[model samples]
Target: MKNSVFFVLVNILLCACGASANAPSEAEVFSSAHTTPNVLMIVIDDLGWSDVGYNQTTDLLETPNIDALAQQSLSFDNAYAGAANCAPSRAVLMSGQYGPRHGVYTVSPSARGNAKARKLIPIKNQRGLKTQVITMGEALKSAGYATGTFGKWHLGADPDKQGFDKNVAGSHQGMTFHYFSPYNLPNIKDGPKGEYLTDRLTTEVINWIKTPKDSPFFAYLPYYTVHTPLQAPEQVIEKYRKKGIKGEDAKYAAMVELMDTNVGRILTMLQAEGLSDDTLVIFTSDNGGYRTTSFPTPIRAGKGSYYEGGLRVPLLISWPGKIKPGLDHTPVINADFYPTLLTLGKAEQPNQALDGVDLTDLLLNQQAINSRDLFWHFPVYLQAHHARTDQGQDPLFRTRPGSAIRSGDWKLIQYFENNEFELYNLANDLAENNNLASQKPNKVAELKAKLKAWQQQTGADIPTELNPEYDADINQKMIDKILAKKTHH
Candidate 1:
């Protein structure tokens, strides 16, 4: 009887051990056992879709580090920026709302170009992001993450006021006056004489990541390289010049390479600190490239224009073992990142409604997200960079007050100036060279109805009142001058 009792006791103990093994621990339940990943988002300023070597569109530019990252990441071919330009695009990403929701449609004043060229009174623009809106940093920080932003924060004057625990060199300023040290930026102090801005920003992020912490971190490194005032290291520029790429093109190429090199450094540090597998790395551009400097070919116009070139950008998401590396052609925008990161970090949704969809399934299992129409509303005017080569509707302006929607493969752009519609079948013509509005009335009607409904839903303002300063003759003369110059060239 004693021997039988001993065997029974052993059986009970074994069962208890098995039960403990099957049940999840407290750390596992909360995902605090390093299961909750770190987020490192690197945003490049004015980098084009075809600038990277993985795209194989440009032979002049070299980006080995970015190309390597692309090989191990889920590259998005149809990813787009929230807006065509800098300030508005950054606002959309931060707020996870459309331009209409935040009332930040363009940079500075809504009136751009000559007053006589603007037909309608454009909507008033908001210079900075309102503090009331919840930012990604705040959302992640609320979920027990250490949030830090190490670069441009064009949304507001202070990033710390908005969800970030640490802000390096971010401010309301759109672009840096100089890429070298003595940047004159409010937050950052002067470094050595020739210290580059991109390099300094990357170093700051690396140092921030190195700090000991109990919780995971969200490192937002928005490098201000590859933008205007085209300056690069002389040696790197010389290297490009030797390859027959001289002048501004050589300087641009050098800037791109330097940015890629910094990205490599970050990747190396993550591995060194044993944070590679525990981190989710995202690399993308704020908008499309500057037209004259890095024109995205076969995609049409760049920067301010709402063409494929201006909206489309390179996107790569890498999570060592968690996310499988491959190419995803699904159409996505920067605003989508807001909900996606929140979901991945297990953060609660804010009180305000989010316009973007959560991409967790798409990021993890390679499953496709629900089909939805993408919209862009610009109730403001943006003048052309180079009227002759901007490839916009007209030479005078890159974009008039307009609203655009992309439903499936069809894209419709409605201009408030003329109440006119320009439609294109993107699947067949990615360049947006052919307008099928005249040929397919049913398709145009369908898209227009959808766009109209979206406009009403989003409360997108449509400028209708005519501008008192608009002069038809003056606009015509400017157009004529641009045309004459193009013809002469």
Candidate 2:
């Protein structure tokens, strides 16, 4: 009888052990997790790294909503836009390729302006994303998720042309004169006169989220605030002016404040809809701040240049219950958004080669990002000339439209214009204040070879011979007109 009791006890212990082994551990669940999270890409126009409250580069600006969102999200401190300007960067974000590859190099003009003027500047062949290539919107749409875009669809003339099912306030134009006016390009559903453009965009987003809680969605809100011809409602302007800000700076600050408030409203809407946990919200700028006086802090140079300030922007991603909060110091680019969003949606990736990697893995798993080169090409430079201001002299000779190849901490800027070169160890010098090309001849040569090799592999289009006789100034008025129509009303 004692022997029988011992056998039964041993069997009971074995059964308990088996049950424990079959149970799922938290780590195991995290490893093979597949949740179809809705994606909200909130793209702020011309916002700098210092503009957001979390980065704290400027006390002149207030972004409480963004700051609160950052607390719950994984913030990328070293994130960069694909290009220094709007169109190219937006193109890169839509298609997981560099600006040079997709052919949308320059910013789009307002729809009402001269088409002949556009031919002269000829947006970097990278302007129009190839129809054959899949966009993030297309991927989500195919997966039964509704895709809607609210503002600044600079990817193409029509969001329908690029795959967005709903495109409100979208246009080919990249700039606007007033946030609210009848001046908007004809296609968008223009709001009432005197309406705040940013506020209208937020209302559209909130309405979309409220109606579509049944399936996943991808809502892209690219605001036209703080770009150029900086205009804001007088009420908002007075609010900031009371704080000692006056003139154009105060108007710019007011626009940013309105943008922040609207963004916060959208976040609040997501929470109210009870979609915060199942949705992923991302806030980033197309490029750096357009204002030269703007502080990018550790980075040097502003928009229209290849400096860190021109490329780097604030990146905040909030995925409740999935992403661990706090800062991610690793470098990320706009191109990564395409692949990362598709991966999160559990959609099939395109067969072609993509320049961006799946950043979600890097953010969640804390895995070391594999060393990969990032490249940029800007052929035409537009030095901004504001009304009657000492806008500074244009460089005597334009640098030959150049290209840069960054691997690890070393970045080599190759000026094809004169075969001139500049190199920096970005690890130590974020401002790019020092040029080490002459000191490190061997490293320069090595990086040059790598850049050339990549150009060959990617089949990058070398600048074709064009007559220097072609003048870009002939269309200035037309370009301005097109830019003005991007606002509200």
Candidate 3:
């Protein structure tokens, strides 16, 4: 959570990332006995549903290994990230509660848009995870598990302080300077010249798993790949460019392919080490793709937007002998992972209050959770990427200060700025192309009442203080500038 503008070292140390490292092998090793299930939660950064073959197949992108893994996994049809952006989503996943509990609505201060364009003064955001709250690593470490976090941590400096035994590259910084050496990242040392950050991190994981340990390990591989400052191998970039992909699309696709390659490496290592069957591999992303790089269709706008495109993400859970393999449409969010993993690992539940329910039943037995309503609270303003092209309610921002909930087939969103509600029956309109709030007043009332009650119960903050500098004329002028740009294009 960077409260101020982040700075990075301009010069890279120039080191080999991991080209000479031992190539992956198909050799399978064995052990005497398996006591408990190991957890391998792979949280990829800023990936969308349509980016992978499992969610939406296209020759435009190739993710054969992930697709194969999906075939052997219980893939979710309606999976969601905790928040519409990065840090808050990770916070929700780690804490197992909504924004109200953790107060990490977005990275840094929540008031993102220009002051004149904003109507309300956003709720102040916490820059780091508090020590009072129990983290996932801390909970699992207490349960006698060897916990290691190998990539971007974002929350704070030194995950070791938060109960991790081994942290290869994790700290207070959110994104690396560039995806290369001399990253200017805190707590991570630079490798050899021309080393790719993704490959280096993958090698680190491989080495970690190779070490024979007594307790079942919790490998939290939160890759910084598929994120910004997009950098990849020249050959990989050339491969996608040959397919008619160019500019940001090609660079982004190359990085995605590289990420999938590294993921395949990890999966292969588990199988080779005879750890596949006993390990539960949970795969998902923090949120959707950034609007600038790549965005898949049928869902609405990209990452910052609150529509399905930003919230809905790809989720896959695979445990060879324990869980079944197939598709499941049980609606789920990132918070569910904390309680679900605690229960599955036979760990003690924390004393503090948790908003998510234990989902071990759903994970192992394929049971559906259709009754509980999943919610998201973002009492902040997120400016739109491209007001003309980006799918957002108003032109100023992708999402204004708002709270949203999805219960069964209906999903309702309440924007605090205008006290306006937008309702959609997802069963019929998955894209949320139609707003049924005006049409079905009764349905709107029912869901709105529930949302309001839940907010009060959770002590959710609603931004009400007017931004004294707010000017309607200035906001309209900004909107007009975008409109004018679009017309010219």
**Which candidate has the highest lDDT of all?**
1
TM-score for each candidate, following the candidate numbering = 0.92, 0.84, 0.91
- lDDT of each residue in 210-312, candidate 1, tens digit only: 9999998999988888888898889999999999997999999999999999999999998898888789999999888877878787898888878888899
Q: Runs in model 3 with CA error above 4 Å?
A: 1-35
2 versus 3: better TM-score goes to? 3
Clashes of each: 0, 8, 6
Residues 19-116 of candidate 2: C-alpha lDDT, one tens digit per residue:
57765443333333547888899998889888888887568888998999999988998788988788889888888888656666555431112333
TM-score of 1: 0.92
- Angstrom error of the Cα, residue 226, model 1: value is 1.3
lDDT of 2 at 146: 83
User: What C-alpha lDDT does candidate 2 achieve relative to the native structure?
Assistant: 0.73
Native-to-model Cα distance after best TM-score fit, residue 270 in candidate 3, in Å: 0.7
In order, the Cα lDDT scores of the candidates are 0.88, 0.73, 0.82
Worst 10 residues of 3 by lDDT: 1-10
